[model samples]
Target: MDLLDDESSAGASNAPEFSVSELSGAIKRTLEGAFGRVRVRGEVGRVMKAKSGHMYYDIKDDRNVIACTTWKGQVSGLGVLPEEGLEVIVTGKLSSFSAQSRYNINVDTIEVAGAGALMAMLEKRKAQLAADGLFAPERKQALPFLPEVIGVVTSPSGAVIRDILHRLRDRFPRKVLIWPVAVQGANCAPEVTAAIAGFNQFTPGGALPRPDLLIVARGGGSIEDLWGFNEESVVRAAAASDIPLISAVGHETDTTLIDFASDKRAPTPTAAAEMAVPVRLDLMAWVDGQEARLSRALAQGIGQRQQHLRDLSRALPRPETLLNTAAQRLDLWADRLPNALRAGIQSRQVRLAQAGLRANMLRNLLTTGQERLTTLDRRRPAALTRQVNTARRHLTATTGRLRLSLLQQDVARKSEAYGQLSRRFTDLARAQLQGRRNRLDTLDRLRETLGYQATLARGYAVVRAGDQVITTKAAAAKAGSLEIEFQDGRLTPQMEAKAAKSRKKPDTPPPDQGTLF
Candidate 1:
């Protein structure tokens, strides 16, 4: 038994050798080869979309769970995005990532598993959007009465576009901008969303005119075919559009999320066009009716005014009848005019005589005025003298009432004030004089301390050659005569030498100036 065990161990060791990477690669190839493509039906588990645009999720049944991955490029093509607790069918190939050493399905397309699942998702999404107020009635816009340019969002090759164009032509024709887009399938939502946003981006009066109105139309279809319009992106784009939009995505019985979010909803594509504009024929007929009514009203008004004018003419008097009374009065005045002139001449003569008498009265008044002026001149000097005498008497009376004691007291107070002021002035003068003396003494001391004499007394000296003081040896050498000064006296170089000879030692004090003299 021991010999067999050793042989079996040697056989097992020689069987094969593989690194971890090689082993994982082999398993990956086997998985992809065995199940090249598959359709998986299960309820989606946790769904996570990375910032890198890759989607990672799980599909699970009663006990088994399968990992799934959808690349960024493939994500947009998905018919129904996987959600937690939603049953879906995913189509892709089975593959294994060597780095993770785990097997997963590389999902290419995903869709709701059944009608029940689709309806459940739609209801869930509808509730969420309603909660966000995207479906609020207040958000709806009023469509233009007549749009100058209409932008249509629909499949270019579909009957829906043809129907809309035909209906618009039959109604009030307008400039139409057709934005071709896929109406159904995985590309539907993104294309429709882009179309809506693109239409709104146009600048008004630009090279391409911006649409006053937008129509998103599609022929009648089942819920599955119309599912793209129910996408959150499509619904939000419709809701947020600045241009007034009319959604005609399905038949009258078919409803979509866009219908709720759009500015208006039409039962069919053709119906949306009709709502966009009024009937041209009807508009012209109404205008003609209004013009006719205006003309008839204008003519009736003119006729009524003419009849009223005739009635007013009957009440007015004739021109000749009005002038007759004035003419008769003029003739009567003409007959009396000469007599009135004669009386006026007599009256004027009487007035001239009265004026002559007034001239004499004025001459008498001038004489009286001259006499009065002379009298006033004579009285002026006497009145001025009397006023002056009266003022003198009043002053004498005022002086009589004065008290001698009060006057004496006033004089005493004045003298006391003057004496006090003089004392203060004398004290101030003495202080000022003392301050000046003190300052002068300080200045004198400062001067003495700074003087050369004071420096010489402190064992220093100033050498002099005549008026110039010799400070350096070079200056002394250049001088005609050199003099050296000690603290006690000034000496010529010859005298210094003689004094050194006479001195007992070099350290001896110099002779005094008085001694030198």
Candidate 2:
């Protein structure tokens, strides 16, 4: 109740008052005006992408944190997308949302804070990928000794690709397929990944042959400039590639995550080319050397075989000596041939005389044969009659089995079944034909209902110029001669003119002309 208290209360009452919305707005404006644009270096936390494609995340330090947002349109242009626990430098304008009563940054670009941050992220990613066995030696494929087609993924404008080509040409000329891509940008990872997958999609014997070896090459650059190769997407793609891949991302001193994932790693782009093919001169020299060795071995083998043949021949007896005994035996046999023949003839003559084989013995044999013939002739008629009786019985039995009535019955049964089947077939064919006719009629009706002629029946006339119908007034105006079609018939320009003439009243002859005035 003091006078000073009253003065203080009255002063407080005179102070300005604001609604919730106005106060929030005023604060937002002040905050935005104070920090229009800024670059904040902090560790990203709780990274998220909205369904609307805007990225939402928090950038925090030990003391405080700030909410950050990257609109969908600007996300792609960012050098790197923010991940949780990643320290990044964010560049953006400050913004405040009155509804949320909080200030946040509308991020324009985001990148790793420095090489240390990048290395830390790279190490984390490397550990994760290594745990997944992407760097396992057993998963790697051996490169082809000489690939028919070599696919290169690099920027076409860069000197790296030119160096690779030049090196390849100098070593051994090969068919090179260039899949041009951005080597160092936000687009680099996606484009290079897609190139690897696209090369794998080619059919082996297709018009564009599949590459036997893949070489992903890029020139030397700083860690940040070569970060696209370190991207998770690029590393994953390299590890998953079915084709043998050689990563030549940076100089020997500059290592990237892709080097560990690739099937082989080259220190430089030129080194990658060297790994892809062997020197032609060296290959030719090796081939010549192998040919010479093979020829010498062949000559040595032939000489050894000839020497063995001569040794074997020395152990064998001479042909004349081996045949000497056989010749002597042959001569002895030939000398005794005439005497043996004469002795055999004399012994055969003596045996013939002792046996008494003469004309009387022949007559006795003839008499015995005549007696045997007489006995056989006596039994012939009886055998012939018995055989005839057997043949007759067989014929009678066979004739009895062939009854005409049975054959007629079988024929009638078959004929009835055939007629039934034929009738059924005829009925089925007629039904199918009727169904087809009904379908055809329905289609014809549908065609008529949908056709423009049906529209003409409803008081609409179609104006045609030649065979084409004119639907618009502009088209009708352009038509030199109109053919108007109604449901009844078409009225051509000539027909219309004739009808107008017929409808016109006969021109009244000029009175002066008719009256001869």
Candidate 3:
């Protein structure tokens, strides 16, 4: 037994050991061989997307979690990205990442678990977006009656595009810009978003004419196939687009989020094309009808105006009759002019005869007045000489009295003015001296009130450290010594160690405050 055990121990000691990487690779090959392809049903969780166009996420059940990865090439075919909390069935081969030393699913196909779950998700997203006013009627734009250029977003090879072009051509031929894109897959949302944004980014009248209207169209399909149009990315892109958009994503019964966001919703791509342009024949007929109505209205208006002008012309008097009346009045005035001149001359003659009679009466009155003047002239010389001597003596006495009164009044007025001036000067000098005395007294009182000695006398002391006044306890604690000034004198206070520590509480009242006086 000892010999057998020794041989087994020697063999165990000689066995080879594998490194971490070698063991991981071996496990990877074993898992790949055992479960080459698998189908897992679980709720999605913790989805992470790499910038390299690769997605990494986990699918979890009540008890277990499995990591999943989808490469870029396969991602475009994924109708919808696996969102967190979404229940889906993943179909792919089980593979191990040797670098991470972990096993995961390399997913190639993902689908919602059931119709019920998909409907529930759709309803939830619809309610969430509807609450955000994405479907507001006020936000919908009016489609252009006739667009110069119509941009279509659909698969280039699909019959949907052909249907739209045919309908547009039949109604009214227009410039059609085709932006080929995936209509119902993982790439659909992003492609649609980019196309809508590209149309908006165009500068009008540039190398590429900016579209006046846009049509987002696709053929009818199952809910799963049409889900890309319902994606938040595509819906938001449509809502944010500047150009008027028409959504013809599926059959009339198929509703999507893009339908709510689009400016107009058409039952089919052909219907969308019809909405984008008006019928050329119908428009021409409408224009013709308007032209006929305008012509009739203009002719009727001109006839009415002509009839009114004729009525006004009949109401006015004839120009010849008016001139005949004027001529008759002129002839009558001409005949009366000579008779008026004769009457004027006769009145002047009567006025001249009255003037001659008045002159004769004046001559008789003048003769009477001259006879009376000769009687008074003989007695005038003797009376005038006697009156002149008496008048001269009275004038001399009146002149002497007037001179005496004038002299007395001048003397009295001068004496009174001199006395008043002397009194005013004395009063002014007294008032000026009083004002100066009062101002000097007020200045002296103000000086005494503002003086520091006055504040000290009021039970306040100025504490100084060197030349600076110490207003706070912190300054006193920092100083080696302090000089306290009172109204009577100054004293030097020595700071104790306890006082320095007590100064920490600056808000506390000083212990020697009561004894400061």
RMSD of each: 34.6, 38.8, 42.3
Model 2 poorest ten-residue lDDT run: 354-363
Question: Where does candidate 1 clash, by residue pair?
Answer: none
TM-scores, all candidates, are 0.59, 0.59, 0.57
Superposition TM-score, candidate 1 onto the true structure: 0.59
Q: Give candidate 3 regions above 4 Å deviation.
A: 1-19, 50-54, 71-74, 96-102, 128-134, 314-517
Per-residue alpha-carbon lDDT of candidate 3 for residues 373-470, written as tens digits (9 for 90 to 100):
44444444454445444545545566576765664455456445544654564466446545544554554455456567889889999999999999
Q: Model 2 over residues 346-417: C-alpha lDDT tens digits?
A: 997675554343324544554565566557556655765675566555555554446545554555675676
All candidates' lDDT scores? 0.87, 0.86, 0.85
lDDT of 3: 0.85
lDDT of 1 by residue, 75-99 (tens): 9878789889899999999999889
How would you order the candidates by lDDT, starting with the best? 1, 2, 3
| Candidate 2 pairs with clashing backbones | none
| Candidate with maximal lDDT | 1
In model 1, how many backbone clashes occur?
0
Model 3 residue 407 lDDT score: 49
